[model samples]
Target: MRYASITERLASLGSEKWAVHVEARRRKGQGEPIIELTIGEPDLPPHQSLLEEATRAMHAGRYRYSNGRGEPPVVEALVRKYARRRPDVTSANVLCFPGTQTALFAVMLGLVEKGDAVLVGDPLYATYEGVIRATGAEQVTVPLRPEHGFHMQADDLERSITPQSRVLLLNTPHNPTGAVLTADEIAAIGEVCRRHDLWIVCDEVYEELVFSGSFASPFDDPELAERTIVCSSISKSHAAPGFRSGWAIGPAEFASRLLAVSETMLFGVQPFIADMTAYALDNPIDTSARMRQSYKSRADQVIAGLADAPGLTPVAPEAGMFIVVDVSATGMDGEAFAWALLDEEQVAVMPGSAFGSGGDDFIRISLTVPDEMIDEACRRVSALAMRSGVRKELRA
Candidate 1:
């Protein structure tokens, strides 16, 4: 028997959180229920209108291959929705894909050639490096310091750009860190990218999840808008991860190239799914105010809980459904601490080191669970610290 050699590019990338979750599930079998706070999966149900729209589309026999670019109605609806937020983009600039992950992959594949370099934030979405690796592009990470609230420094990003650098991946209200970029930060990044003549790929999946202030996108600037590809999805906003619907909005030229790549990669997104997503976008099930309130409540609970725990101090999350808790005061590496908590208390959380080097002494917890679960998980985690004699190290 012969097997093809696995690509060298994927050799160094491994998701510790996923591996541990899978192993834990395998050991528990089907009987024991694991309280999952590791992955960023929303527990809420998707919009009922989305389900109704899907059912209607199925009844109407609309489950065929869609236009490679996406169904016209769906694209038009996306254009209108985005126009309300970003007036510069039109329907012609949008290309629908199965999900934001796929859209990201398509954009990277279309723009990055072999040996090209791309800049990313440290402790970023773990998959960014993997996607860049798959394209044979080198990933240079710019550190987002905890002291600075995980904000990306424009100077650091600019310094990382070399002649081979072609792309800058920016995730605002960033994953793991939950730090939203300020308007000034966005403008600085825009200026740097413009000066470097680098394309900006802004991942704004958590745009609507912001708690304290307005979400700023690099696309807000006319100069940056032309060079920016905004990739987003309904997974975070509408709790519709299973729907697998997302879009990439950019210049018409870039959209055309991305459409070509998406068509060849996945043929076309399911027409019924596209239609359902369009319907949901048109009539949001939960008002944005209600959703934001719920998330804010959860964020507050998690932050307060962490504050009470010994040797654990979590930065207040500005947006998104995650909080990164610093565990350096406990004098233990994040991976070891995460596994110890899981084994001793049966609470599952992602080790921050899985994200990047900047996350080495922290752990990331998702706020997707209920209030009671969040309380219980925090109690269990705090118990571990008390047992280890680290409870006195917490800062007052």
Candidate 2:
């Protein structure tokens, strides 16, 4: 029997990149001691109020089928949320989906196809390539150099845009690197998109997790409004990943066009979940503050722990829940270091290569663990780095 070409495209893009994480999990599952800092699951639970709202909606029987676009209340809440940023935002400019991942997939499908190209930053989120590839479009990567704090430079972006380029996929408070783009930086990138006649599809899932600076996006600029589309969710913001509540904000016409694509995929999220999501957006809770503080503190702890460790250097993140540590000085790339650390010290972390070649020399450590766990993981990581350095000296 034959399958769709998508199977081939996605086969090589699957969990193989996560071999270290998977093995660490398997070991921990078997009762082996392992400090896992691989994935970005929030260490906390959803706010009590959000939980209560979901229960209330359930009791009120919100389980009926929803419209192709989204549940009314959720759409309205989204409109109000974006309206604060863009006074012109309305229901027609918003469409809700299960999560940022689904919204991104739909947006990509609607914008690009086999002959088109999607320009994204290298060292991107792990799933970004898979999503772009699933659309049958080519993924063109522009380097996000660490020398510039991993933010994508506009000149690099302009150079990568070819005649076939149709979209620029961006993530702010970016995953893996946790680099946030300033407003001026966004304007520069948005200008490049405008000149190249490209759609700007930004993933702002970490918008609420910025520690030091305010968040900015192309969606906030009127000049780029027509071409800018942002996908975000409450997963990180509200610590409610299981809810699968997210939305895409764009020009009204784009929303109008993407609604059919969304409908075909899932027909809209569960109404009960939509109700819970509406409550979340409208109530305006400050669920991210604690996360911001905790993640920042943990990141600082990791940096401090590795300060004296030879062959290890932790990059300070501007925002988000993970910190990137450059371990190339140890004479091993990220994948090798990650596997060795897990085997020798029982500490699990994601290799930089899992993200992209730009991160090959680094390891991404999630700060979503308890303080003590992260501290312990930091200790083990430092020890590994020291050992690798000593081994290098002996070889010399």
Candidate 3:
């Protein structure tokens, strides 16, 4: 029997990238003392006020279906939050979804399709390729070199554009690498997009997770507002990933046009969740601030622990909860080293190859674990790297 082309396009795009993570989970289920650090789940809980708000709304009968656009209160809250970033932002500019993932899917569908090209950075978030491929668009990967701090270079973006290019998918406080783009960097990339008439779809899910840099986005620039759409959620900012509350801020017309696509899949997010999301945006909380401190400290711990280890160099993240370590000098690629570390040291980490070729020599470590756990994990990783380095030297 034949299947839709989308099925073929997305065949290995999902859980396949998470092979190491899946293996680690299986081992842990069997009672292995695994220091799991593969995914980016927050170690913190949702703010108490946000939780209470959801419960209150649910008890008040907010379980019913919502409109295609979003719950009114949620839209209003989002407007006020974003209006500070771009003063002209209004309810019309917002479209709520279950999370940044869904918002991105809807936005991509509205912007590109078969025969078009979507320019995205290499070493992008694991799900980005699947999202773009699902739309039948060709994904043109622009190399994000580590030497440049993994931030997407405007020159590289411009070099990758072709006549078929329709959009530039960007992520700040970037996943895997945690590289945040500066205001000047954003303006440069925006200029490239403007020159080519490409839409900029930025995944700002980690917007509030910055540790060492100021955050900026194309959406914040008035000249780029019409072409920029920002997708974000309370997942990281409020420590509420399970709530599945997120939205897209874009040109009103784009949001209006995408409403049909969003409705076709999921008409709206849960009303109770919407209420909680609204509360999250309207009230400034310390959740993100706390996370910023914890994640940064944990990352520093790992980097410091590995400082004396042979052949392992942990890259400092400017933002976000994950840090990458270059393990190429140990005479093994990231996948091999990751499995070896799990088997020998009982530590689980995602191989850089899971992201893309750009990350082939690296392994990503999540900073969501406690300090003690991070310390132990760091020690284990350092030990493994030391052993691997010795083995390489002996072979030489």
Candidate 4:
């Protein structure tokens, strides 16, 4: 029998790996040291206690299959952590998974049907679109305007919702733009969802990284909590990316449905990592304060540097480690500018176009690299401005 063609949704999904490969080849050929500022990966080490616990678990042969939901201790630890933040939510609402991405995928599989519509913010995390497409769902993008500080507008959100809209995917302390939604804005969106009978899938991976204001959840409202699915991981906040431990919190019915899908996806997460992750969660390191301050400094520097460079408008990020800079005045698209910077200056930044239409003239810069590297990248960007005769305007 002839093999069936790839599904349309799968065909539409583009691999970010291709961009990485291209950069690698270019760097090798040029004999240049690439200062990678593309991916949002923390360069910090994991908690020492977590490392010790993982070592013990490895020696004790604790690598066996666990309950598909998660090991009891890890699940309990996650429940306690979540309860501390969201007292209204119960342990029954939490389900552990290998990572937040896995939980998101499971949630989409369980909730969205073929040809269904899902609302997503423009300049959203690129991986989200792939996950939505994998479910054979249509993605309706809601533009987040830079003029409004890149925050989501409830009116715009409501206007985008349709009868086919089943879920709204949101990332606050959002990726690529680092815009955090205020509690009032979240409440407004909740009200819209309440009226429209929509489900919300919120990615709060960077919740602990907020600098200016208290972290707010869509689940902060009882009515919205009933319809919200929170997917969070220890990767960003705790600097434990390798642990691959995350949890999903939502209505028990939805959790059960997602659990069923999760079982078939990966059977269960590794018990050793889960146990170590629980240890880290219960005994959190005092890194949040340090990490937040460092990122705050970087964010300020990036904003100031971009201001000095002509034709670059940088959005000041209140939280998270990314800033989106508009480069439209340079007479080049985001993709072209990104490639030129990577090739000429050996700086690697993601093209804003990779995010979607609203990102055409923008480039996303991650502060995951060292402070010195960021300074150098800014200097190179300034040099480019000077070469292009844009510096004259800034000097004036």
Best by lDDT: 3
Show the lowest summed lDDT stretch of 10 residues, model 1.
387-396
Q: Give one digit per residue, the lDDT tens place, for model 4 in 50-118.
A: 889988887888899887778888888888887786786666787888888888988888889776999
Instruction: Tell me the TM-score of model 2.
Output: 0.99
For model 4, the superposed segments whose C-alpha errors exceed 4 Å read 1-7, 17-22, 25-31, 389-396
TM, every model: 0.94, 0.99, 0.99, 0.94
lDDT of 1 by residue, 1-396 (tens): 754333566666755436656655665686565667887777778767788888999889888878778887789989998788778768889999888998898898998977799999998887888888788888888889888899998888887888889999999979988899999998998899988898999999888889876888888777787799999988888888888999889999998867768888887788888898888778746734556677678778877876766777878788888888888777677887888888888777888888888888988888888889989988888888776554335532
- On lDDT, who's better, 1 or 2? 2
TM-score, cand. 1 vs. native: 0.94
Alpha carbon deviation, residue 291, candidate 2 (Å): 0.3
What overall lDDT goes with each candidate model? Answer: 0.82, 0.92, 0.93, 0.82
Cα misplacement distance, residue 172 of candidate 3 (Å) = 0.3
Give stretches of model 1 more than 4 Å off.
1-6, 12-17, 27-30, 390-396
Worst 10 residues of 2 by lDDT: 279-288
Could you tell me the lDDT of residue 106 within candidate 4?
85
